[model samples]
Target: MAPPVLVLCRLAPDTLAEFADRFRLLDFYASALPIHAFLAAVAADGDPPRVVLVFGGAPIRVGAELLDAVPSLRCIITISAGLNHIDLTECARRGVQVANAGGIYSADVADYAVGLLFDVLRHVSAGNRYVRRGLWTERGDFVPLGSRIGGKRVGIIGLGNIGSAVARRLEAFGCVVSYHSRRRKEDVPYAYFPSARELAASSDVLVVACALTAETRHIVDRGVLDALGERGVVVNVARGANVDEAELVRALADGRVAGAGLEVFENEPNMPPELMAMDNVVLTPHQAVFTPESMADMRRVVVANLEAFFAGEPLLTLVE
Candidate 1:
């Protein structure tokens, strides 16, 4: 008999079929009840699932209570690069191993970050709007001037895989790159700042690519925004909570900061109304990691980790 696996998020029908071939899949998304109620029913059934597969945007939360309900649960596999939604400490304490997508989306996200930066600097989206609205026909080629990307000082937060990829791409465009991480990376030649504010002070553009943790929540607050000053631009591909959204809105409204390119928001699928009216701001619906290549890579990593766990092999991409 195949091992029992609980699935807690929406996935492609083909992906579900693939998993079903290798495991006895218990799909929570297909259940009529809420996730907690479903888990309660499963717990009452007295045969706890041994593995759980989670995907991004799942409402099901893995906390101590949930873990306790599934006494036989040993592993969790998440198909996302970020693990902010998971309780790592609780999982560790309970001897429940956790695995993530393992940098599969890094290149795609980095490419999107650079694309956002370019859009902000060149006013690409705004220009398209101007053309579509017939403002160009009335104004006769008198659009506002855009800043040149070359020779700009770029500061990156979290010099991890995505950050490093962004740095490399920016370097090809003749932009000088510096970074701020939890600690300095010895291998990289880029200048390192001790804090976000310090990095913002020296950079013409600030790119946030860090992971969200307790220490990193609101890392790009008002102070850092102010240090970037009125002429500075911010491009965030990281978690929305990493930047204080209220403060960011205030700064943008008051012209304390020049502009922004955001792919994520504090409240997802619901962005601030003020940002909608701003021509200087460029917004995307958290699609930085949504490329077909990245999705395939993510599926591979997630499946590999699950297969490793079930086969009694060392798990790949173990969260630690």
Candidate 2:
């Protein structure tokens, strides 16, 4: 009998069907796995399957535990960009091949990032709120408004696929784009800054698109915020742990930075109380890659990953 493939994250019908047709798919699972508490069912079933595919947004904690549970597991496929949810060390130790979909959702996230930029900078959301509250009728009195994104300085941290996508989108809006990465990428046309602080200081909008690793955990700290000053706005589509939650709250609270558009938080589903109270900021529940197009694309790639594995071919989009 072929080795069983355990699928997690409850993929869409087509992706599920495609995977099913390609592999010896195991027949137990459900939707809505709480990411942080993903291990709530760590090893609930009988024997662990040989090939495990995690399509959900759960963290590496669950992945680590799965390695322990599924001693026979030889491969893991994560359907998202961030592998922080997958335990790399344990995978290496056990010789489990791991793969991820880093570039799959880049465009969607970049569009969302720029959307937040325009909304916050142009007061688009606030303007809608203005009319909803019947304030537009008494519009003779002027509300303080800001300038357009046109020609505004945009600073991007992490010049990866998403960052480059953001740069291209922002550039079309007539915004000047500069980026800072650990090692500068030579292919992109944007100007490069050596440090986050320098980029934050130089741009009107500083966006965090870098990965969340030891080198970048809370890289967007108080010093970086201080450098950004009161006129600059911040946008983070990357993992929330990239910024110090307390410092970000304080920054927006005291006008250290003008505003922020945050889609991810340090502790999701439990936002800081201060964030809810702020009108200048826009928050999303980790929905940067939640668009229909992106969702469809994500599903397609995930199925392909599983298909490739079952075919005894190299995995698509493997994580280094």
Which candidate ranks first by TM-score, i.e. highest?
1
Candidate 2 Cα deviation (angstroms), residue 119: 0.3
Tens-digit lDDT string for candidate 1 (206-318): 99999999999999999999999999999999999999999999999999999999999999999889999998999999988877788778777877888899899988999
lDDT of predicted model 2: 0.80
For 215-268, candidate 2 gives per-residue lDDT tens digits of 999989999999988999999999999999999899898888998999899987
The weakest ten consecutive residues by lDDT in model 2 span: 35-44
What's the lDDT for candidate 1?
A: 0.89
Model 1: lDDT of residue 242? 92
Give the true-structure RMSD of model 2. 3.3
Q: Give TM-scores for every candidate, taking all chains together and pairing residue i with residue i.
A: 0.97, 0.88
Candidates in order: C-alpha RMSD to true structure: 1.3, 3.3
